[model samples]
Target chain A: MIAFESVGKTYPDGTVAVADFDLEIASHESVVLVGTSGSGKTTLMRMVNRMVDPTQGRVTIDGEDVAATDPVALRRSVGYVMQASGLLPHRTVLDNIATVPVLRGTGKAQAHERAAELMEVVGLEESMASRYPSQLSGGQQQRVGVARALAADPNILLMDEPFGAVDPIVRAELQTELLRLQRELRKTIVFVTHDIDEAFLVGDRVVILKPGGHIAQIGTPEQILAEPADDFVRSFVGADRAERRLHLQQVAGREVVVDASGRAAGVLEQGGTP
Target chain B: MSWVSANLDTIAEQLLAHIAQALPAIVLAFVLALPIAKLANARGWLRGGLTGTAGLLYAIPSLPLFIVLPLMLGTSIRSPVNIVVALTIYGLALMVPSASEALRAVSRETLQAATAQGYAPWARFWRVELPLAGPALVAGLRVVVVSTVSLVTVGGVLGVPSLGMLFIDGFQRNITAEILTGIVLTAALALLLDALVVLGGRLALPWASGRAPRRRTAPRDTGQEAAR
Candidate 1:
């Protein structure tokens, strides 16, 4: 469990990034903080790993204060994934994945064995083990990034717009992969993104933030969609958007679900009454 | 041709002396420049101060440096150490700025990623930063190698007995072949050392070579794998 106790961050230049923010993330829960630029979503996520230390208050993991821990050791024990994949361009995929374990004193051969297994888990071919990050496609590089993050098997995974650089199709594929991975390996995940749809897709609970890291709303996607807390949440989630309003319609004598835009979303299942 | 044949032993001795002086300067300058460059990269004031010092050091003429260095070091004017030390100062003048630029070329994202992955500062420097800076460092080294080799000839003016001695003796005696031999040998030596540096770079950084060709071919292999 990660807890941010009234945390705030003010830069040396006097820019208040996060002001009096508070949140508690339960163990094994994946929470997404979705906001625009300057909303401090990334700042909040980084505080969990001490990448950005709070100017006021504290962040604790599993009832232990993170500030007291050595930042390097704390980072080694946490998994971090970021935009642009962030895999070292000079290292081969296998070596990149094997980095954390080797740092933690695992023998080279043993770490590499674990890395090879992770490559399979992350959908990379055995041949790619020898190739550098630059040789891989964007999607493949992200997979390597994911593999590297999972290499240490850390309890918490911090993903900051991890899919933002890839094309939409590839982004969707990675999102699905993350969902599948989460189902099997139930690590506590703190995801930050500007994309609300992505937040809804990947997060168990979504945190919508306004301009100052202030929570506009916090709820499951269904709850937030059904009852927006205020006007800001409604506009941010696009609850009033035509595409979000869905109804059943008869199409070719079969009941089909259609959005307010009249676009057919799917066919209504026969067993479930609408 | 007769003059060349007569002075073959002398030429061989000078060539060896040339290598002895130039190689150490080339190596020592590079070794010293890396740490200085890293220090300079730390802050704006440090960069300005260090690079300014380098530029001032480079501006001093080689003959003057040779004469001045002997006085400072208490070495004999004709000692090869004076020549080596002088040329090393010259090499550092050229190398420091180039090394600074080379280190700067490593992306911030790569460094941050290494840190976030839990690499200690020293470990990150060795494992990530240094290797990524390799190609640029090699490029800087090639310049240092050629300049160092050519600069060793200047020591002959101080009676340091290098390839430059041929030019001095030939000039006084009016022997065109001896002068020609000196120029030819010096240029050839520079080229040889430059080639060696290039070869060493290729060997050390295998991933840097033929990047465009690799990029074109790699996708096909992966595409085939994807089809399976």
Candidate 2:
């Protein structure tokens, strides 16, 4: 479980990034913080790993204040992914994945064995283990990043726009892979992104932040779609999109709901709520 | 050409002596520049000051430096040590900025990634930063090698037994052939040194060979390409 108690961050230049933010995330739940630029979603996510410490109030994981723990140890204990999929270009994919484990004093042989398994888990070819990150495509590099993050098997995973750099097709594939991984692992995840649709798709609960990292709304995707907390959220969630109407339309024979973007969003079973 | 052929053995001996003088300076300068670079990497003011000092050192005329170094080091001007010391100083001055810039060339994202993965600073510097900086460092090394080889010819002013001897002999006795031989040999030596550096870089950074397929496909249209 993670909790933010009156958490706020003000930069040295007197810019208030996050203010009066409060939230609780249950264990095994995937909570996404969604916002545009200046929403401080990245800053908020970074706090969990102590990359950006709060200037006021506190953040706790399972009732232990994160500020009290050694920053390096705290960071290593959490799985982190970023937009760049920051794999070290010099290290081979296998060594990159094995880094955290080796840093924590695991035997090199054992760590390498675990990294090989992680590469398989992240859907990378075993042959790629010896290749450098620079030799891989963007999607492949992102996969290596995921493999590296998961190598340590941390209970808390913090992802900041991990799929933002990929093409839309690749992004969808990675999203589905994350869903599959989540179903199997069930780690507590804090995801950050600017795309509302992504948050709705991947988040168990989405917390929408306004420009200053102040929460505009926090609810499940269905609840937010059914009832937006305010006008800002309505537009943010694209509630005006035809997909939110939830009306059943016959596609050949099966009833499906199509979004305003002309894509099929969901299918409705017979006599089910649209 | 006849002059070079007739005196092939003497030319060979001088070539060996020139290499003996130049190669050691290059090696020593490369070794010394690394620590200076590492120190100046993160601090802007320090890097600027060090680079400025190196620029000043480089601007000093080789003959004057060659003459002055013996006095400073308290060595005989006739001793080969004077030439070695001066050449080493030149190499250090030339390589300092190259080394620092090469170290800086490693991207911020890569460093952040290393930090996020819990790499202590020392480990990150050795295992991540230095390796990524390999290509740029090699490029710097090539420039220094070529420049040093060319500069060794100037040491003839001090009568430091080298390929430079041909220049001194050619000038005093009006032997155009000897001067030509010296110029040609010096140019060849520079090319040889540059090639060695290139080959060393290839060996060090095998992954750099085919690493940028994506960038190649979308090659940024710099104005030169458009103009062509």
Candidate topping DockQ: 1
Q: What is the DockQ of each candidate?
A: 0.41, 0.26
> How does each model score on lDDT?
0.90, 0.85
Each model's fnat?
0.38, 0.34
Interface RMSD over true interface Cα atoms for each candidate = 5.6, 8.2
lDDT of 1 at A18: 90
Per-residue lDDT for B145-170 in model 2, tens only? 88788888777777777898897889
Candidate 1 per-residue lDDT, tens place, B86-179, comes to 9899999999998998999999988988899899899999888988899999998999999989989988888898999998899999999999
Off by over 4 Å in 2: A248-267, A270-274, B1-13, B38-41, B173-185, B211-228
Pairs that collide in candidate 1 are none
The pairs that clash in candidate 2 are none
Regions of candidate 1 where Cα sits further than 4 Å from its true position: A250-254, A270-274, B212-228
- Candidate 2 chain B, poorest ten consecutive residues by summed lDDT: B219-228
